[model samples]
Target: MDDPKNARRSDSLDLAYNAALTKLDVATCEAMAVSQAIDVENSELHLGFSVQIFKKLCSHSVALICAVPRSRWVKSEFENWDFACAAGQSRAIIEGFLLFLYLSQTPSCNAEWTAKLLVLYVNDCTRRAKMMANVKAVDAAEDWMRQAEELKDRLKLNPWFLNLDGKTQKRCLAGDHLMISSRDEILELAGWEKAEFYAIWDLLSQYAHVLPMSFTRMEPDGRGSGAANEADADYLTATIAWCADTLHAATNRMTAGFPSTETVRQGLDSKFEPGPKENRP
Candidate 1:
C-alpha cells in the first residue's frame, strides 16, 4: 500500500513538470509569432504610418505577458519570461519606428513628430540643467542658448516640414509669431530651468534644416514611395539578422550552462555515427 502511494505521488510530480515545460514552449512560440508579425507589418509603412504600427506592437506585448509560465525556476527563466523580453523589445521597436516616421512627407505628421521630439529634447535639457546647477558653471547659459539655436535650425529641415527655401525660411522665422509663441508655451510646460530651456531651443532649431531625403528617390504615387520601400526592406533585413544573432547567442548560452535533456541529447547524437575507439598504452 505504501509503495503504491509513493508511485502515484511521483507520477503526479512528473506530470506537473511536463505541463510546465509545455507551457513555456507555448509561450516562446507565441513570442516568436508576434515578433515575426511585427517584422512583416513594419515593411508596409510610409513615414507617418509608424506610430500606428508601434501602438499595435505595444498591444501585442501586453498579450505576450499572459502566455508565460508563472513558476519561478532559475534567474535565466525569469529573465526569459515573455513579458520581460517583450517590454524591452517594444521600446527598441518604437524608437526605430519613430526614426522612420521622422522621415515622412506630410506637414501635419512632421509637426506632430517635431512636437514629440521636443518632449524628448526638453527632458534631456532638464537633466543637463540639474547637472549644470550642481557644478555652477558660469558659461552654462550661453552654451544652452547656442544649443537651442542649433535645434531650431534642425527642426526647420526635418523631412516632414518640406524643407523651406532660404527666403521662406527667413520669413517664417521672422514673421511666424505663432511658431515663436508655441515654442514659448512648450518651454514653460516642459519646466526646464533657464539654461536647459536655451539648450533645448538651440537643439530643435538646428534640427529644423536637415532635410531627410530618401536615397531611392521613389516616385510619389498610391503604390508608396520608393524610398520608403527600400528603407523598409533594409530595416526588415537588419531585424532578421538581429533575431538570428540573438537566437544563436541564446542557444550557445543555454548549451554551455546546462546539460541537454535526454531526448535532445539523443536527437543530436542521432545525426552522427560513433567511430571505433583507439586504445592507448
Candidate 2:
C-alpha cells in the first residue's frame, strides 16, 4: 500500500497538473478562435503579422497539450518519460510566446514595425540561402543571398532603421532578430521578470542541449528502477506550469488584439505561475 503521505502528495500533484492542463486548453482555444476570426488580408501589416505569430503560438500550445497525455502514457506503459524532449518543446513555447508578444503588439511608431518586418524578411532569406548552400545548390543560394541584399538595402533606407545606432544598424542588416529591444525589455513587455524567466530558461536549456547538469544529479529510486517516480512527476508538473503560464499570457495578448475573445478568456479561472527556479533540483 502507498504511504498516506505519498498518496496525498500524488493527489495534490494530480489536481495541480490537471488544473494547469485545463488552463492551457482554454487559452489555446481562445487563441484559435481569434486566429480564425481575424481577416488577415484586410488588416495592417503589423496586425497581420501579429495574427500569424498568435496562430503559431496556438499550434505550439496544441502540441504541448497533446504531449502531456502521451508523456503520461509513456510513463505508465514504458516506465520512462522523455523529459528532455518535453523541455525542448516547452522552451519553444516560451520563445513563441515572447516573440508573439514582441511583434504582435503595436509599436510606438509604424516605421519601427516596417523596419522589423524587413529585417525578418532578410533573416528568412539568409536562412534559406544557408539551407540551399548546405545542399550544394550554389545558384539557388546566390539568388537567395541577392534577395537578402536587396532587403538589407531597403532596411538601410528606412528612416527608423537609419536612426538606430551604428552597431544596431549593422546587426539589423546582418539579419539579427530581437534587435528591436533588449531581451529584458521584451520580457518586461510580457510582464515577466528577466531573472526569473532566464533561470527557468537556463534550466530547460540544460536538458534541451543534453548538458551535464541534466544528468549529474540522478538519484536512484528506492526500487532501483529509474522509471516513473516523484522526480519525473516534478519535472512534468513544472513543464505543465510553464506551458500554462506562457499560454495564459499569449491568450491575454490575443484577447487584447481581439477584444471579443475577452469574455471567453476571463472564464478560464485556472492559472499557473512559474517561479525563477521552478523544477530545478
Candidate 3:
C-alpha cells in the first residue's frame, strides 16, 4: 500500500510537470518568432550584435529542453530520472539565463554596450589562455593572453568603462563578470529573491558538483539496483519548474528589442512565475 501523502505529492508533481512543459512549448515557439522578427540591418549595430548572441543562447536552450528527458527502459520505465544529470543541466539553463538576460537588455548607449562586449571578449580570451597553458600549449596560450591584453586596453578606452571604479575594472580584466551589476543584483533583477534562489541553486550545485548528496541519498531497490524514486521525481520537478520559468523570462526580455514579440508575450505573464510573490495558485 502507498502512503496517501506520497500519492498526493505524485499527483501534484504530474500537474506541475505538465504545466512546465506546456510553458516551455509556448516559450520556444514565441522565441523563434522573435528571432524571425529581428531586423538586423535596420537595428542599431549594438542591438544587432546582442540579438545574435541572444539567438544562439535560445538555440542552445531549445536543445537543453529537448534533452532533459528520455526513455531508459523498454520493459517498464518510460524515462531516465538521474537526479545528478538533471540538476547539472538545470544549472546550465540557469547560468545561460543570466547571460541571456544581460544581452537582451538595451544599453544606455552603443559605447556602454561595446564596453560590455569587450568585457566578455576579455573573459573568453583569458579562459582560453588559461586552458591552453594548462595543456602546455605555450604559443597558443601566449597568443590568447596577448589578445586579452589588447581587448583590455580597448575596454579602458571606452568612456563607459573609464567611469567604472578601479576594483570593478580589475574584476572585469580578471574575467569575473561582464556587467557592472553584481551577480545578486542581476538575480534580483530577474525577480528572484536572494536567499530563496541561493537555497535552490546550492542544492542543485551539490548534485552538479557530485558532492556527498549525490550518492548518500540513493537507496537500493529489492532488485539489487538503485531506482528512480521520489527524490529523483523531486529533482525533475524542480528542473522543469526552473527551466520553464527561465524560458518565459528570457522571452519577456526578448520583447524589449523585438517589439513584435510583445503580442505573443501577452497572456504569458500568468503562466510561469518562479518568485515567491508572483507564484499563482
Candidate 4:
C-alpha cells in the first residue's frame, strides 16, 4: 500500500532510532554498575579497587555511547547514563586518574589523602611565588598573585564555607591564621580552598541547564563589547583552567567515596521520613 521509497525511508529511520536507543540502554546499565562499584564503602583497599573497576566500566560506556549517532541520543540519554551521569562523568574520570596516582605514589592511605595532594599543589604554587618574587619578574609575580587572590575570593564564596555562616567563618579564619604561619602553609591553604571551590563548581555545573549561559566579557551590561584586554583575557583563561582542574580532582575524590549498591539499598531500607498524616475523623 505504501510507496517503496517512503517505506524504505521509514524503515531506515526506525532502525537508526532503535539502534541508538539500544546502545543508550547498554551504556546506562554499564554506568549504573560502575556507580554501584564506586559506592561500596569498605576498607580503602577495597574502595580503591572498586574505583578502578568503575573507571574501566566508564571508559567502556563512553566508547560505546560515543559510537552512536549524536542526533539520535537525547540529553536524558547522556544525563542519566551514570551515577552523576554524563554531566559529571568527565570530572569523575579525571578524579579517578588522580586517585590512582595518589594510591600508587603515597605511602599514607586514608580518607584525607586527596586533601594531602591538594596541600602539595599549594606548596608548589607557593614555592613558585617565592622564586618569582626574588627575580625581577614583577609581571609574573603580579600575575601569580592575581590568580592566588582570585582563588582566595572564590574559596570564601564556596557553598561549604557560605553554609557555615558566622561561627564557621570565624573558626576557619582563626585556623587559617594558625596553620598558615609559613609560605608553604599559605600555599597549601590556597590550594585546598581552590580545590574545594572547584569541586562545588563541577557539581553545580550539572544543573547549568537552568542558569543563564550568556554573559558579557568586556562590559557589565549584556551588550556585546568590542573585545576584552589581553591581560584580562589571560587572567580569565587561567582562572577558568584552574577551576576546571580543581573540579575534576574534587569529583574524583567524591566518586572514590561513593557507596556500593548494597550500602545504598541498606541505608534506604533503614530510614524513612514520613509525610504529614491526614486529619483523623
Candidate 5:
C-alpha cells in the first residue's frame, strides 16, 4: 500500500526531475548554438589540434541532454539510481572539457597536446573494452591503441608508450603520461573552487553506487517502490543548473572569436587563438 508520505515524495521527485531535464535542454541548445558559430558556412572552423576535444565536448553534452528519463524509465526501484549516475557522469565530462581547454591554452593549439589527448582517449577506450570483455569491441580497442601510438610518433614524441608497472592500470606509455587527468587533477588544473564540484559529485555518487546513505534518504512504501525527498529535488536542480553553466563555458572557449558568440560575454577568458591546421596529426 502507498503511504501518503511516499506519494508526496514521489510527486516531488517527479516534478524536480522534469524541471531539471528542461534546464538541461536549454543548456544543450545554447552550447550547440555557440559551436555553430565556429561551424558557420564558409567561415571554415579551424579546430586543428583541439578538434577531437571539441567534438567530445559536443557529443557528451548531447548525451546528457538525451539522458532525461521519464516515468516509463522509472518502473524499477533502481531507475532513479540509474538516472542519478548519468547525471554524475555528465557532470564529470563537462569538468574534463573545462580543465582540458584551460590547459591547452589553445589560441595556438599544437600537435603535442593533440597527440596526448588521443593517447588518453585510447587508454580510456582500452580500459572500457577490457572491462566489458566484448571480443569484437576489444579488437577495435586495440586498433585505437595503435592509432594512439602513431599519433604520438607523428608528433615526434620520444619513448611514446611506457609501462613502468606491470599492472594494466599502472602501465603508461610516454603519451599515456599526459593523457587523462583525475577529477582532483582537473580541479587543480582548472583553478576552480571545489565546493560545488565535490558537493555535486559526492551526492550523486551515493545514488549511483547504491550506498546506504542514499537508501536512508528514500521514502519506501510497503511495496518495493520508493521516492526521494525534498533535498534530492534541491540538490539535483542545483547540480544540473551548474552543469549548464559549465557547458556555457565550453561554448565560450570553443567559439571565442566567432560572430555567433559575440554577445556571449563573461569575465573568464582563455588566451584563445585559432591555430593553423598544418600540424594536425
Candidate 6:
C-alpha cells in the first residue's frame, strides 16, 4: 500500500526547493548584470593571474546569494537550516577568494608566484586527501615534498617576499608542510596588512565551522538558531542582510564591474526591510 504521508512530504520538499530556486534566479540575474559590465578584453586590464581568481570569486559570490530561501512555507523544525549552514560555509570560501582578488593587484599574483603557490596548495591538498584515502599514501606525500623544494627555489626571485621575519625566517616547506608562513608575506606584497586580514576575514571563519561555541548560539525551539515555524522570517531576513553586506564588500574589493550590483543588492536588501515580525503558526 502506498502511503499518502510520504507523497505529501515529497511534495512539500519539492515546493521548498522550488522556492529557493526562484530566489536563486533573482540573485543570479543580479550577479550576471554586474559581471557583464567588465571589459576583460581591454589591453590595459592587468588580469592575468587575477582572472582565474575572478571567475571563482564570482561563483562564490553567486552561491552566497542563491542559498537564501524565498518562500514562506520553507518552515521546517530543522530541515530549513540546511541551506543556511551551506551558505555560511560558502561565505568563508568567498571571503578567502576576495582576498586573492585583492592580492592579484600586486606582484605576488604574478605567474611565477601564482604557479608556485598553486603547486603547493594543490599538492598539499592532494597529499592530505590521499592520506585519508590510504594511510600509507607515500607517493602523494613525496610528490608534495618535491614541489615544495621547487617553490623554495623560486622564492629567491622575490627576495623581500619574506620581509616579516627578516634573516631568521625559518621558511622552507617540506613533506606535509604548507607554505603558511609566507601567507602574511604575500598579503604584505599586496599592500594589505595582517591586522586587517585578521580583523575582517579571518574572524568570521569560526562561523564556517561546527565549533562548540556555535552550538551555544542555537536553540531547538525553532525560535533560536535551529528553525522556527514562524520565527524563520527573522532568520531569512538576517541571511539577506548578510548577503547584502558581503556582496557590497566583495564588489568594492574585487571591482568586477557588475553594473547591476548596486541595484540588485538594493533589491535584495529590500526583501528584508524592517517590517512586522511574523512568528505565527
Per-candidate Cα lDDT values, in order, are 0.36, 0.69, 0.68, 0.39, 0.52, 0.46
Compared with the true structure, model 6 gives a TM-score of 0.53
Winning model by lDDT: 2
TM-score of each: 0.24, 0.81, 0.81, 0.24, 0.57, 0.53
Question: What's the residue-level lDDT of 210 in candidate 5?
Answer: 69
Candidate 6 deviant stretches above 4 angstroms: 1-30, 33-46, 71-87, 108-135, 160-207, 224-226, 229-242, 252-281
Model 4 weakest 10-residue run by lDDT: 272-281
Lowest lDDT 10-residue stretch of candidate 6: 272-281
Q: Model 3 — TM-score against the truth?
A: 0.81
Give one digit per residue, the lDDT tens place, for model 4 in 1-281: 87999677656655544454443433333343334444334545535544554555345334333332232223434312121223243344434444444433323434234333333334445556667989978878777666645544544655444444576445333323211123233335335465654654554354233233212232432122213223222222233233234333433443446533323222112221121121001
> What stretches of model 3 exceed 4 Å from their correct place?
69-77, 221-228, 261-281
**Could you give candidate 3's per-residue lDDT for residues 1-281 as a string of tens digits?**
99999889879876766676566656655565566656777876656766775666556555545544431101234445566655766777787777766765678987888888899898889899999999999999999999999998898899988898999888998876666667787887788888988888888898789788777756665111235466676666667677767866766666776676566443333222221122222
Q: What is the lDDT of candidate 1?
A: 0.36
Q: Is candidate 2 or candidate 5 better by TM-score?
A: 2
Clashing pairs in 5: 107-273, 160-174, 161-173, 161-174, 162-172, 162-173
216 Cα displacement, candidate 1 (Å): 62
Worst 10 residues of 1 by lDDT: 272-281
Clashes of each: 29, 0, 0, 6, 6, 3
Question: What is residue 45's positional error in candidate 2, in angstroms?
Answer: 2.3
For candidate 5, what is the TM-score? 0.57
Q: Which parts of model 4 have CA positions greater than 4 angstroms off?
A: 1-3, 37-281
> How close is each model in CA RMSD to the real structure?
22.5, 7.0, 6.8, 17.8, 9.8, 11.3
Greater-lDDT candidate between 3 and 4: 3
lDDT of 3: 0.68
Candidate 2 runs further than 4 Å off: 1-3, 70-81, 216-226, 261-281
| TM-score comparison, 4 vs 5, better candidate | 5
Candidate 4 pairs with clashing backbones: 39-258, 39-259, 39-260, 40-259, 40-260, 95-252
